[model samples]
Target: MTLPASAPAIVVEGVRKSFKDTDVLRGVDFDVPRGSIFALLGSNGAGKTTLVRILSTLLAADGGKAAVEGFDVGAQPHKVREVISLTGQFAAVDEILTGRENLVLVARLRHLEHPQQAADQLLGRFGLTDAGARKVATYSGGMRRRLDIAMSLVGEPRVIFLDEPTTGLDPEARLEVWDIVRNLASQGTTVLLTTQYLDEAENLADRIAILHGVRIIANGTLAELKRLLPPATVEYVEKQPSLEDIFLTLVGHGESVKDRS
Candidate 1:
């Protein structure tokens, strides 16, 4: 089926999934605008990953419809797979392979021309040029995550699913991944991010949807969600830098601190 250029990159309507007796998602619906970052915010066990799996064609939904790049995820899974990529909570990299090798492997699998060149370009694009030759086992968490994301981009997929992309990273590493995510959207890749971090959704999403009770409890831009709260009473207080702010500042500015990555 042909879709207009203005159609959303992803569409989920009444999508439902159940694990035996447990209902994970119930009548979930959302639209992800092309070239935008859409975050699925929820606590653990909220079925965020389940929803991603269905949308990415990794798992079949029990009911409802989902499409990626205008292809039905259930009916045209192969076509959906052609235009989408999935990166799970953990960094999926081969420990024995060098970062460059990993990227090259994915490029070759995608049948891209000059796999080596593709890998090198991605290494540089993701700031992994210096670590490209090192075994992934030797990579820091952030580097591994970067390489994982780079692999996902091998085919220039129109939609990318990132499930808890920063689950096990330090603050610095999280910031690194955040920048990469922002860059992805800037380059017109539709990103569906499933994260439990409120600040993460606030920091990255163009629109955020809160999933709870097997349903989407809230959906809107951050500003719109914030408006749901009672009007703020005017107050005066000295603003203090957050611990994250201080850590980033000091760690970035301090010359003698050991590398924590």
Candidate 2:
């Protein structure tokens, strides 16, 4: 799909990566609009994380160009690092540390002036204020995921890469994290996440790119992607609403995004 003339937050072109005899990414390409959520979907071993690693500057691409916020990821690695954060598939917080401690540790490492205040503020933003002193070992899967993403935000990054941010979250918790991501985008931060969940891509992503066989087979808005499928021949006798339908209705009524930044 053709994007507008606005500047892109991410630009990837003809990117390639290989692992020994295997080619993981074969000339993948896409652009992410600034201040929007872009999702990468792929089957297992389809090179989603490899592309993310290249974009996040954790791994090098064998060929082609990648830039984040206009800084060449290959040529200006440090500059690229300055503008983005990454949350991996699993929680990155230390199980021994309390939620607040985890934030303070990350904030102090980032050299924030008021580490404690920064930690407290993040706890409140992620709805962990009441559990601030509890060790992460006691935290639920959803709570741990929230803390992980919160830690990634300690630096107020312009962009964040979430590798399945809601992997193990329950429906209610998934909605909570969705709110966090939406709130982030609403406040002008670019969010790029690789997810296996189709509903997540539908609910959160402004654009979706599907990776298959080391290449991006599809890239576009949800509507555009739907158009790629052949029209359904079967008529719907009486379509029933999904759980997500009910959830969206409830959330639409009372959701509020308190600016954490």
Candidate 3:
């Protein structure tokens, strides 16, 4: 298939990785479009985390080439780091510091001229303005997660790698994080997310790749992926609604639905 004119935010060709004797990624190839959300779905030990680490420049691939924002991940690590941000499954906030302080620290680390101003703006944007003065230890899980994501934005990265960002968040908190991600995409940021929750991938990802056995078994939009399976009718009781209906009610509309029927 022909790709768009815009440069890919991420590009991987024949990427491979191994730990000791076990191979993690086996000649993986994919391209994530700029200013779009790409979901990488995989079971535990399917090498999703390894792929994220390699893209983030935290780990080097054993073979092949990978690039982020047109900069080679292995050759131009500094340039890749400058344009990308990575948020792991767990929040990494300083418990001793206030939310505002955490953002300020990140801003300073990124060499922002006005760290305090940038911190305040991010705090307000993430709905933590009122609790900015409280220590991170006093913040709830959701709050800390928000703070972690806010910290990643301190450098205004063009590409973000989110590995199960809402893993431990409550339903409400997950929605909040989803909104934040949507807003970032709307602002022209490229997001590459690894998620276990199929619903989360369906909700946020413009494209989804299902990784199994160290390779991508499926790659497409949700409808396209679903279409790969044999067609079947979903039976439901007239009076009793199904889980799918409930999900549709709770999560609102899915973009894939329109394309399916």
Candidate 4:
């Protein structure tokens, strides 16, 4: 079914899911606008992954409904799969294959008209052209994760679900992935990101939703969410740079003072 351009890229209404006896999601609701980033923020066991699974058609919702690109997830799973891509918590790359081979494999699986060209283009796009011939097993965590995300783009999916894409990456690598996500949104791809990092959501999401106790406790843009709390009272104090700030500053300029010594 052809949807109007104005339709949301993804929509979920009263979505509920459960295990044998425990409820993972209770009437979750949200919508992702086209060409924007929507972050689902939650701590562990908050049903973020379960929600992504249902939206990506990997699992079924116990009740309610979800539609991706206007195709019903439960009733039109094949259609939903056709327009979406999913990246999970860990890098999903084949260790035996070279970076280029991993991309080529995904392109071939997607049955692209020119898999080699597609793979090469994606390799360059993700800054992996130089490492394309190296075995994935030899790749760094960041490199492997970049390749994994590149593979997810083989078909130019309109909607991408990134479930904790930066979970295990180092700070620098996490920033790299953040740049890639920003680029994707800039290029008209709607991204649904589930992350436990508050900074991640604040930095990337056009709108953020907090999931707690199996329900959406809050949902709004960062500024709007901030409004939910009482305004801060003005105060003067000596400013201090955090350890992370000091670390990143040192790294940005090269070796730390200690390393030089």
Winner by lDDT: 4
Where's the lowest-lDDT run of ten residues in candidate 1? 252-261
Reference-based lDDT, residue 163, model 4: 97
TM-score of each: 0.89, 0.87, 0.88, 0.90
Go through the candidates in order and give the C-alpha RMSD of each one to the true structure. 8.6, 9.4, 6.3, 8.1
Please give the CA lDDT of all the candidate structures.
0.86, 0.84, 0.85, 0.87
Candidate 3 per-residue lDDT, tens place, 200-245, comes to: 8888989988777787767787777656543444445223322232
lDDT of 1 by residue, 174-233 (tens): 999999999999998999999988789889999988887899877888777655543344
Shift in Å, residue 244, candidate 4: 16
Tens-digit lDDT track of model 4 for 127-148: 9999999999999999988999
Better of 1 and 2 by TM-score: 1
| Model 3 lDDT, residue 185, Cα | 93
Clash list (residue pairs), candidate 4? none
Poorly placed runs, candidate 2 (over 4 Å): 1-5, 234-261
Runs of candidate 3 with Cα error greater than 4 angstroms are 1-5, 234-261
Check candidate 2 and list the clashing pairs.
none
Instruction: Please give, for residues 1-261, the per-residue lDDT of candidate 2 as tens digits.
Output: 222438899999999999999999999999999999999987568798889999999999999999998899999999989889999988898999999999999999999999999999999998999999999999998899899999999979988999988877789889988999999999888999898776888889999887877888778887776555334343444333332232222224322111110
